[model samples]
Target: MRYTSAIGVTTAITAGLTACGGPASNGDGAQESGGGASGTIEAGLSYPLSTGFDPMITSGATPYAANMHIFEGLVDLDPATLVARPALATGMPKKINATTYRATLREGATFHDGSAVTADDVVFSFERVLDAKNASLMAQFVPFLDTVKAVDTSTVEFRLKYAFALFPSRISVVRIVPKKIVGADAKAFDAKPVGSGPYRFVSAVREDKIVMEKYEKYNGPHPAKAQKMVWHLMSDPSARVSALQSGRVQAIEDVPYIDMKGFTGKNKVESVQSFGLLFLMFNCKDKRFADKRVRQALHYALDTEKLIKTALLGNAEPATGYVPATHPDYSKAATVYTHDVAKAKKLLADAGVKDLSFTLMLTDTGWVKDIAPLIKESWAAAGIDAKLDIAQSPAQYAKVDKGTFDVLAAPGDPSVFGNDADLLLRWFYYGFWPEKRYGWTGSSAYKKTRSLLDRAASAADENKRKELWSQVTDLVAEEAALYPVLHRKLPTAWTTDTLTGFEPLPTTGLSFVDVGRA
Candidate 1:
């Protein structure tokens, strides 16, 4: 109340191994049992360990999911609802003034290493993120924060540069970490994280699995329900389905759309419409895409509805705005890219463009691969020649960050961090994506977006904030530089009889904070 708040590989062999309850190989190529000690929640995760477990810098889906269990922010979002709630703190930070906040640590809260969680730890956690040298992924989310000071051992004070209406919930972006541990060896802390959460980091094998045990010292609202958790990094879709069907794992995330019906009655399979989306981003500096009309034409060219039906099996909604229609700050954009091949061609012709041809780079995620051909077909229908270059996420992003790619189709869900419209919008438009990734910082439109977002962030009136956000929504939509093609449904599968209190999340990844083995 206070919170008020992939791979496939040798399909037959992997499936057969999991089905036989045999040991699975981790990223280290070491054999480990899919089944762990009693009271362990075994899950098959679709992603491999792409990043480290440090909450401040972790961007990979799998590691981010792991951090949800291994760490805690003073105010954490409810795993299922995305509503802000007190975790390490006693309650929501008390608003001291228009630009200041104060929060008290929960009594007796201790880090997994048995160190008491102090205000200094909280201050350190924030300063590191605020410091540009750390290059934390979270710094962009808290641009209004001016400083964080330890008011006392148990109390932390936050001073913001301006009044931010969402400060209470937005601070959930930074997870509290022990100063002694992280300050001693930052690199070691990244590899093996320590936090004051329900779970303690036991071990992690890059590609194979991540093991965590319930922290006996944890005394929080959501204490661990299971003694241990073993997350199998099974990038292959078949391995995940097989692991779930064979009872080798109690739950699995990213259930392949094609395999949804197969687990109908046998397992509880649910597809929750999520903010997660497949977005199309372009290199604004490219000579061909330098014109905004060229960007708009590409969006109009795509038959999104047909792509959803064919590639996604009708499991996604065409993008009507920057955020999905289900989002709380939903506002219909000024220009929605509905299918119109004629309009696409006309826009291209008006822009004085001819023989538009470029390579469209994309990730090799199962659903993305499925839609690649359809995307190409849709563009081809509009007289555009798009060469497909599909690879794993890291490789594709490597090329993108180097500014060597033309267009990229990638899956992104910032909702996993927080669900507010400002947060979601800023994730792309405000920081790294525009400045570096897509090369849109030089555009006048980008400056306008930044101004509108800053003004909205400081707006005290809720309605006024929404109004500004809506303006941004329209502007970004019309710009069409980096926009969503469709918001896809996240499918998850689990056995109700084997695990109690398990529910599919509307965002990416799976949560088991209060879940237990039956």
Candidate 2:
């Protein structure tokens, strides 16, 4: 696909997975532009458009980033700090009773369409998300919420099914949208989103690019600094680098680990440790993996240090616990697996496994592909025969979700939704993956893990909650149904001289909230 620049010159963008090199071009075209400083900001992302802009169900990288600009929740998370602060609400929601809370809307707030943002809009937003038929990915996060209703024109109240201590942080999962527009045509609304945010949706070309112009009437704490923003969906890593080098784009994300040192001077690069993890998941229904000993054995066999150093080029840190050490609430799990082939072999033998064999399914993520061979080699050393089946995330998960695979090695960053322990842990264990996908929900261990997680979620005492969370972490680590191997750092590159206030995020996607072109 090609992009037509402001002057009607078409710049060809290469559209396949290929080696990273200089930016693609058909001849001399527009180059070296910064969005925040002088003109429209042109940015590049490594992934293409996968989902829509609806905050309740959207999970794609490109769409999620667009939602960051096009929508605002009651309590919004700072893209950099991951801290929850007031956005649409006047301040943090006040706890009225054990199971009820109230928040007042900011005065003079209006949607991009110039319609007033009322308590009804907020109620509709949460109702749609909480509705089970909608299958909202966010519904799982707010299990405690029973109903949201308008108290008056500006005030809104929430009644929880049970007391939830992390209600403030959990409420950040869904962004408020206009009821009239969305209720008219949900599909059309997804394509053309309307929100009270820094930027308003202009157009989207699917896997090519998405455009957003500044919402002139935005009255939020963070207003649009740039007049316009163009997000180029370049799945090819080389294209992203080339766009950065040619100045076609001022900033780019998911910088290739091998090219980190090549950036210099005006082009600055930074890699922040993120909760994004490469995890190993087992199909617990399979007899070979039913025994906890066998699962622990496989984890012990892998030389994770060697794998990270060689395949990841030392860009990742081993998962010391379920959550990365960078997480504020990090806990050290009881059973920490290090490279010990003898221990792995012993565990396998003790489980009455003479010759272990399994098919290892993995996603086609570039980094995972590089690490796949090392995984097979490590398992082979422990006398386990492993076969690899590599495919995209959706395809791989489809097979895993169907109970067709023996093991899965994939990279997932649920931190994009919310960075708290309860949300992060529940993502894999509480609702879907453990029970329906991994077949572990029927087990006693899975039940215990769920109990501990729920106990942690509702605990009023912070210390007691931490202790329960730690217990859950230790049980999951010992069971080894689905656990992280390493928490990788996210590397983002930008022209320091041009783009100001642009900070790299620990989660997925880039933030241009306070950014301005220098």
Candidate 3:
């Protein structure tokens, strides 16, 4: 990562009361980033596999905060404001055509190396994601972009195949990576990064920690107050919590599901709710999975109630729908799966399946390890012996796109999912992961799901959109393409209440931007 600094604003929104209970747009253009998060606080982040601190390979919840130091987009969504405002771009995208748009470059923006942030830089960044050679994780994030071109020094345009209502939100996530940000010649830049954000990269000590200092050029209202922020890589959630207790660190993240209760306001420990879904994704085109009965059986075999009780310890809400069971559009009809071994067996037998077996890819980090074992046990309890196929993340995610695996045990964080099912549908049922039903197995069921996604993404009416999503959700649950497990509250168990600003988000990983220590 090339260490660079440039002054720019991520969307700053006006705060409103509606955002209190959950994630909502802030009505105020600029509000206090909350509490006195102006000091250094050692924080913990459980990165998804292989997300090497590099934007291209990086995954999970880091980009919103971590990547803010290395790179940023022309605009960012102020979760509170819910407005897509200028960060890298000077303002909102300039709509140039029915299927195309343009964005003006920010004024006086320069990278850490002091190079001007030009239209070429923006185009280069977009090209990096589109280049199939790089195999960037961001590819899955924006599978629909047909192409991106820099029209001039001050303008960049996007040509899309379809009109995405949340196109701006999608743009909000593509952090601007300086040219040569990755690959063989990327050594120098990777060691340090240059970006137009509020922070500057100071040092990255391998797997131990990455440090950054606040940018003096920052013009935003709530500039980073701390002298420096540090992210320590800790694997064991308990180990991380102990560090917090011992004062080795101010905060720890990816709190174990069972560990949530240990935190309370008495200790100044707060548990915020995040938009995340634990699910069992099935590759529909695979021969073993061609049988809907087999897929449906996989869904029925899970003892989610016991999994939450014994494994999750009330840390999560047993998933019953397509999106997080808590999302506004989630439907009751979507919450279909329950532990019915008889039903699972019947489904399997009906599909003429016996001596059934499949590989469950997992990872050491994230829910793959903790929850995978429970799921494996749950599956075993139903007499389906499954093998564990584990890989280092976010690379493991790449396999999902190819449609190579049988069953994928993963969670859909809203950060990646957006506020809608757009990303989910793209990566799962409707898109090409494992295999698209575009071929032999392709059927009306596939069309129905894809149509739901298309309608959901294009819907202009909010109420109608909500109803459409409810139907989309119920349809997926009924199909059991990807078994939705539970909705989770952001879990953070700490040793003390020294740090603040740990609002539960719709994504994964940990961040230090709005977090400060007493």
Candidate 4:
């Protein structure tokens, strides 16, 4: 990819990755120019918080950065194959044993600086995730870490604490960093990133945007053709859509559900099948939710049909389980939440509950507020009185983390997990608490659920593991640890509808590398 500046010259910022470096390019046919055409595509991203612009605490921002030009892992999933393909890695590593594997580098692949990507760089990147100080939310998934040994300048090997079938895919999220520049503070890397991705960090103009110029000498499987990508930070959904339409911005993520249909006439819209699960979470510790009958009754009271039709504003899909319906293990019925006021009332009456009062803490952004009042009314009809507590950005997370409220209408898109229900139950469905971070611990259900999860994890046979996991899933559903609600779709758009190579990232969102000039 090459570029020459054909338009206005605003500012140019360049940073280096741990392994690779060289003279950065910008625009078409120009040195220090980024890839792609001159036409601007202002992208609008929404978040409760800035994700600190850092990976350690950036639960929401990381995905956007991952998509933009800021980061890259050793390998990336191929859109066409949905298989891990070499990005920084020279070639795919062959498993040497149950817990060991090795791979080589492409020899000349370097950070944006031109420093060659080597085995040591890969090792350093993986180890960083395990650092206790980082407490990467990603740590919960990739836990079995022994060591990343650099066999040689180009070759790296992974020695795991235990055998994992999905190790390669897991590495897809471990964005490699230059061990040299990371300094004592990992948080510092956020402001000054050293990544080998197509884009390099320029300057994070606080509260506005993060700018990146293209690397002129990127030697990867699929580097960005665009010279630069400008990520505009805007939290308002309506404003975002307006910006895109009015040409203030070229692209926006998570278009309002209702406006999706209206955009069909002119704008391009793409929906990627996602691994995300957006569901209502029950406070397992809540007295009313503690009863199985009461939980089931509450589930029955939710009219998913009405919610999807009206409350969701058209950006909704019926959820079967924690995993998206498209996921292979998602075998449950999506029709679990039927509208049955009579049945719901009877179950609540039998549970000996007079009236349930709890606050539904949901985000104020997007369609949440649009739906809160409706859901409150649904529960009220079932003899459950609920109040609405809406918060924005950090305040929402603070409350949820502290467990300061009850009956959270939480929704999330956990990156793709292994085909088992272990991570699903352990990190999410089990409910969250202050000290527990994310687990069923401190709850009455912890001991029993954890034991079953252990058995499921340790089971060697594939069929046996599925059976155990199936039992665990059913058990959690029955316990109402988190009421299964709906699966979310990753709304995306391409330069053209005929654009080829676009594929869904295994982690939940869409990958842009697969896209090409139409």
| TM-scores of the candidates in the order shown | 0.93, 0.93, 0.78, 0.83
Q: What lDDT does model 1 reach?
A: 0.85
Q: How many residue pairs collide in each prediction?
A: 5, 5, 36, 42
Candidate 1 deviant stretches above 4 angstroms: 1-38
**Residue range 188-294, candidate 3, lDDT tens digits:** 45445567676667655434565666666654433565545667767677877666665666567677665555665534355455556677767666778877788
lDDT of 1 by residue, 329-381 (tens): 99999999999999999999999998899999988888999999999999999
For model 4, residues 1-518, the per-residue Cα lDDT tens digits are 00001011112222322113322222122222235433223456654223334443345443344433556666665542445677777666678987888877776777765777778877877777777666555566666667888898988888878776556666665667777767565556655666777666665543355455556567777666555545565767787777767655545667666666656544676555555544566655567676767777877888776776886655557666556666655656323666788888988888887777778787665666777788888888888888888876356556655556576675554443233355655565433331232224565565666667667655557677666666666666666656556665556543333233544343432334534323
lDDT of each: 0.85, 0.84, 0.61, 0.58
TM-score of candidate 3 on Cα atoms, chains taken together: 0.78
Clashes of 1: 5
lDDT of 2: 0.84
